[model samples]
Target: MDRVPQVEFNPMAGLRPAGASFTVFAELREQYDWFRSTVGQGFWVLTRYERILEALNDPERFSSSAITVLDPEPAYRWIPEMLDPPEHTAWRRLLRPHFTPASAAAMEERIREHCRELVDGLAGKGGCDFVADFATRFPTVVFLEMMGLPTERLATFLEWEDTILHRPYEPGRATGRRKALAAVVGCFRELIADRRAEPRDDLVSAALAWRMDGEPVAEDDLLSLCLLLFLAGLDTVTAQLAYMFWHLAGHPADRDRLASDPAAVPTAVEEFLRAHAITVTGRKVTRDGEFHGCPMKAGDMVLLPLNSATRDPAAFPEPERVDLGRHPNRHLAFGAGPHRCLGAHLARLELRIAVEEWHRRIPAYEPDPDRPALEHAAQVLGLDTLPLRWPA
Candidate 1:
């Protein structure tokens, strides 16, 4: 750890309540630039903009197979997301048509209506838990629509998702994860069978009919494909939304500006994303290499917190500031390289509509005094409760 500054670099440290990530990011960059951490069985950490991009921009050097420092038990690779190059390319190509920009755009009016309904429930009420009221429900229901899952069973899907992503992986919760994953796999297996027997106008049915390299997908591969889609489509959006509202509740000026001009939301959303970036996914070193003067060995985990790229002073002036209209914004919030997020288009549309609709209904809101917003950070940074108040 040559010239490395004294900083708390624990992976679990950032996974707790309150916001201290940017502080650590700033401190580390100013001192050591980049270094190694003991967390996740000793990972090589990169935080600077250019250094992070250097790895992401070149997949041949850094492998996406183990896309997280946290290694899942039984060595499960999550389809295209955790696969590299040729294998990833084929699966993604088969699934790409289902999530194109046009597909996301087609669902805009429907998403807007859902946003209005969510706001209508909270409108004129003195306050409500923003996370429970809107953030989680809107995305969950939309995911249900896309998957053709039963809307009335939203609680079941939400429960499975929460347990898998949020409850943690201690010995006590090991059974919890098993139960949830088993339940999900069981349900989706039935859904896939139904789709093959009788096609429907949904992602599952569409994927069933798709071929790659001139062959139908294997059953195990199909299950893995749907599993990743279920987790990806439902989880990240809610966390990002919770963080966005947390930002809006704190910054009255930014909130006011967005509320005043709906057109400014797209750019504002980008800035919000940059400032509040949260995922801490990882990649493995493919071979012996040196990045920014840091040495690494084959099979070493390289932690890439895409959000930290926002704090890179070299890439952004006043890197901490949230400029709603910052142009040429090259934030890696959706990520970089070939294995980037497949649902970016859908995610952007949801955020824009959610922000626009929420502000139109309740423009002036802040953190509730009696019950402050609670922060819960982990592999995914989010808040379990975001209580917001407006004029009664």
Candidate 2:
């Protein structure tokens, strides 16, 4: 067997011609075996499937304290995502119960109701931008509802999330984004203050009243938890839904299979997640380590390309093709280990409901080839705008 070749991380190496719908970063995972890039002065890049997983599982050896590659000035310094070990675990524990299967299952009727209304509004329209009209809005609303925020304030949540994820490094962008996010946090602060006065049946109220180690979660902790939930739940899953629908529209046969068997929705959701897995989680080596015969020194950065890993031939056969009925499918789209996505159950539920409801209404949906879709390339890879049309 030929060993996979390694390449230096040259960001420009993968640039496509102007106006290209897709970029080389998406393709480089398959065409080039591995690439080395510096995250900071000392950090290194691990761009392969096997090594990425190994690093994710061994958080003791590879710490997630460096989740973002951008400089850590501004308020970005304190988000829980940049913390390691016991600290990260503590924050995660506080937020986990709210997303439990029981909790997520309870939201199904509400999710379906939201989906029905969104789709019904555009029911007979000849075409629409799936990303804005449905994908982006749906998850934002669901997350706000979960967090006990007023549904009218969802735009505030979306603006803040986009800033944290996309414009962390840009001063102008960060300023506007942070201001809007701070406003929402201010609202939460008041809500927390109010909940203290009059508690209610919501995550915020529950979190306010709840205790950890005999101390109620502080205001900052409550705000940080809400921030994490907004970033995790809204950004990733919305993009996942857009990508799934894009693929389904292109593959009519798969759409037919799903439309014919609504029961296959769960299986199809799993397959879509596996096939279009987004986000490249980063970790830094805590100590010198060896993975797949490659020496990784302390402070080195590793990129876990979930999409590439899902398609690894060693893991899944015919890794590129969409197999809705794929059995025994185990992919790391949601990631693995302690940092595995906390909202995985809710994300899957959202995807299943979105697809089932979509096909039930528009079985023959297809993308508008004339106006190609757009994808956001950050830590997470996802569709920005997916335009589609069907017979009205």
Candidate 3:
């Protein structure tokens, strides 16, 4: 009888990849019927593609509130996302209007203007760190503008968000993290006060006037909502842009094809998103349930590898290849069902514009071999520094 090779389960292994598409996730999914991990006596992992889809869709059985990864305290909590059922529905209704396609389209001119300015600034430089100069700044500026925040305070906002999401587990990082989070909370408090004093068309102002169950959205709820939007909108979108650019630069053929025909960007963006799903989501099972025929007990936390699902052979044919013209690409990058990303349309728009404009101006871009490629250090995945060389 043939024996299977001994393999150790290492969660940190997922984080060690210098580039996108870590294979360990797919390997674990294929080998283990259901991967399990124990942290402090009661943590579990659910890695199969099918199990993940079931958990993500069945929010009733797997409540997000039970699994508190960020800001677990009640005093400083967010609305909608953390809430389930009737309450979640109420908050979502108030928030949906701000993210409509027509509303996102209204901001296109502004988003394009920002993209042009960012690219133009790097046009003459022989090379630039794409993350710091372009990817990070682009989405940060757009999100701030959308919230009607002052551009001058962009750095402050970035610091606050990074501390909150990126350093959730490090005790040594707590001091600076707390200070930054305080600054964010303070900033939003003032913004809310001002918006309440004088309402405007911006999201923050719109949220200020929004009411639920015949009562105005409480101050804490408003701040949490704003903070969540800032973090969610900026982090994932920024990481995605960095990963897409990294892939395009490495795969020159795809970049060249995209450059020649800008119209290919929308389709290409979908494929890039599908191919590079680097984040994983967690859910706590409310009741005993069967996942891929494995019994899942109540209170079990399931880690759904979105990256694995996008590459599932059953879902996408030739799952490894990047087909620019991949049609009917239904990826879970933005997630699915009720928890689907509210910012999907806007994120797509931002990516399409970034790819189209960058390719048009730079035309021929490549990674600088001399510089060290930067890796991301958040629950979200992306490059911290992407050094690229192109003609001035």
Task: State every prediction's TM-score relative to the real structure.
Answer: 0.94, 0.88, 0.91
Query: By TM-score, how accurate is candidate 2?
Result: 0.88
Model 1 per-residue lDDT tens digits across residues 201-308:
888888887777778888788887777778776678888898888888988998999899999999988887887776777888888867767788888887887767
lDDT value, residue 163 of candidate 2: 64
Q: Pick the candidate with the highest TM-score.
A: 1
Relative to the unseen true structure, what is the C-alpha lDDT of residue 265 in candidate 2, on a scale of 0 to 100? 90
Candidate 3 per-residue lDDT, tens place, 1-392, comes to: 02322234433332333463346666666766465554333345555556667777888887667443222232344556666777778887888888889888998999999999999889899789998899889988998888988889777777777666655354344678678767877888999889889988789988877777888878888887877787787688888998899888889999999999988888899999998885666666778866666566787665666777888777789877889899889888887657777888899999999998888789898999988676643456666678899878
User: lDDT at 244 for candidate 1?
Assistant: 89
Q: In candidate 1, what residue range of length 10 has the lowest lDDT sum?
A: 5-14
How many residue pairs clash in each candidate at the backbone level?
1, 0, 0
Of 1 and 2, the candidate ranking higher by lDDT: 1
Q: Which segments of candidate 1 are over 4 A away from where they belong? A: 1-8, 72-74, 169-173
316, model 1: CA deviation in Å? 0.8
Off by over 4 Å in 3: 1-17, 40-42, 66-76, 171-173
- How many residue pairs in model 3 have overlapping backbones? 0
Kindly report which residue pairs in candidate 3 clash with one another.
Answer: none
Candidate 3 TM-score to native: 0.91
Residue clash pairs of candidate 1: 15-377
Candidates' C-alpha lDDT: 0.80, 0.73, 0.75
